[model samples]
Target chain A: MYVDMQTGTVETIMSNSDLPVVLIVEDEPDVAETYKLWLQEEYEVRMAQNGDEGLDLLDEAVDVVLLDRMMPGLSGDEVLERIRERDLGCRVAMVTAVEPDFDILEMGFDAYLSKPIRSEQLHETVDNLLDRSEYDSLLQEYYALVEKQATLEATKSSAELAESDQYDELTERVAEMRDQLSDTLGGIEDDSDFIATLRGLSEDDNN
Target chain B: MYDLTSVLEFDALSQIRPGSSILISGPAMSGKQRLAYDILADGIDGGDGAVVVTTGDGAGDVVEEFRSLVPDMNDAQLGVIDCRGDGGDQAVGNAHVHHVSSPGDLTGIGIGITKALEGLHNAGNERGRLALISLSTMLTYTDKKTVFKFCHVLSSRLDSAGYIGVFTIDSGAHDDQTLQVIKQAFDGMIDVRDAEGGGREARVLGLAGEPTDWQRI
Candidate 1:
């Protein structure tokens, strides 16, 4: 809605606080526009025709990124790689025509929606991603790791998983994440402070 | 002012109470989801707090359909812990909806349920219903014993909070031992199957004064 036709500029839309930002990274103009149209009413929709443009538009403030696979020039996967490298902390979903295989587990995307996705389905995916934003950063990473384990576990046998170094690394990574959570939350650094935190949340459900 | 189970239209379901967890068992496409949703629908319409842990379906669409069932939706309390492993941001239009990446993330799902329950209680709705859309999806990712233990813990959580729990399963999807193991978490079961001639019929199992007749659904 804030699109400037000539300069391709996005003006401040209602001060940006009223709406969560959604960036659509698709090479196809029509597809990009359609997604934008679907989202613009509720979100401050930003569109990128290619991966580089998508990255240029991305910022921590942006809540979700819908990246198109097989985009010419620095593909979606490569863009995803760069995004992870940057540590922007936004949820990325691959909206791709490519068939999802075990290779997808290697890519660091929050969700996968194969093309020919319905309007409502796209809306649902976006909404769910935002809900994910409420979780602490560690949990976000933890669940992504879990998703990969399940994805690979489904397509491969136990012997195959035992043999694959990638699977081993994934398992190690998941274990490390769990250790981090326990390390951060497990022990009482100060008993009084821990008790105070618990008191804030305590409800006597004994009834 | 209604008792937890008295809101349900079905007489057998109406006999259920607070702190009860019941499983709906049937083959694939046998209308088990409908029966469970109906029970939940009635509970929400009667002003109960509701939570749904979904694996395959999007929480937004599920909430959308659920709100439709309750004419007083604006006043209803609902929360969704979506475990379909997909993520993004849209205001599921209403209610507290949290996401976990996959069924494999049981810890995340557990935390989500706790947060949702807090939200509901904060909103002042006391009695409630919690539904796990299907356990079969979780069964695919975890072992039978793990799922059983998770159900046991979840049922106890609901009991402590004074909420009814309705869960579904594809009876044919898992082995008999697995089915028996998971069923132990619940006080009763709604066994759905094909009627003698046509349509679906269900009977309450494991409850005192059990409904022996297959009530046509």
Candidate 2:
């Protein structure tokens, strides 16, 4: 697998612009400018008139992409391929007029939108993807702590674990994250404790 | 409530409602796959129609295992969506068997599930139990983002259809970030590991109070 290991997150990325980065890759200058105008308030919008420009603008700092599929030189599909190949870890939505076909099964887009999409749709999609990315960042940190504690438990002697200040801090961090997650998860049912959090996540996606 | 005593073989989670998606994450040899199979077979034992989308194992072998678990299993109801692309779709023992050339054919798998559910319902079972043996294999064919969407899409489908779903993954196969992202797609997750006391144990995550408490299996 070409999956890169977890070292940093999109949220942790530092850039000159404080707002999250949104890349718009459309062939039509008018459409690109429209998207830029709509998103510039909330995001640091970067316009790419073509696929090559899109690639040039893409980086780890980019949180989401509004990709046009019918570009001339390099299609949106190819740009998507290049994005994944580069492993930028950014969410992409293929906003195109093209009706989806069975071949979409093989495509790696996070979401698909028809060309007649409204501004609200764009905002909702971008917000949802950003939320997902943020949650993923927290989860990564949580698991990193849990795994660290697990490794200590597996390899260290009881006395060693008790004596090590590092181990003690590790345990504390896990507890803190558990509490944070619980607060985020809301109520838990006896039968569906774990599923309940998933329900919360689903709700978060919607709202 | 659907009884899970046959699956967990303990009281940690004795009953779970239908339409819930559970993910089991554990490193190699942690018995996660075994638990997944147990959950699916337990449903079959109780006469719920079962579907297995096997990407790593052969369909014949999977069928044999299911039969072994529930002897005199309902042959007409079990559905196997073999994505190994080794053979064409067919009916074996009057069971609904569908094949997609590869795991990349997500639409085919989706269609396969619809047919499988219909076949089971036509055979008189009102509910279905769906299990994707492992997502690690699916991740190999696509990026983490796409895999995450696939899980959400599949889970939502099962939820509306009122079916139970269980997906599994190998912990050591992917990075921590990948695991974290995919973990959000399900309603709950089961983390399996070697118990300090000597046997295998599991703890459920994504819940309130003491959700990480591990129980021996």
Please tell me which predicted candidate would have the highest TM-score against the true structure: 2
Off by over 4 Å in 1: A1-207, B1-12
Structural similarity to truth (TM-score) of each candidate: 0.50, 0.61
The candidate that wins on lDDT is: 2
lDDT of each residue in B78-193, candidate 2, tens digit only: 88888888885333677788887877666567767766777888899887788897788888876665566567656656766678888989999987657766775667788899
Error of 2 at A65 (Å): 1.5
TM-scores of chain A, one for each prediction: 0.59, 0.72
As for candidate 2, its clashing pairs are A195-B187
Docking class for model 2 is incorrect
- The Cα RMSD across the true interface for model 1 is 13.9
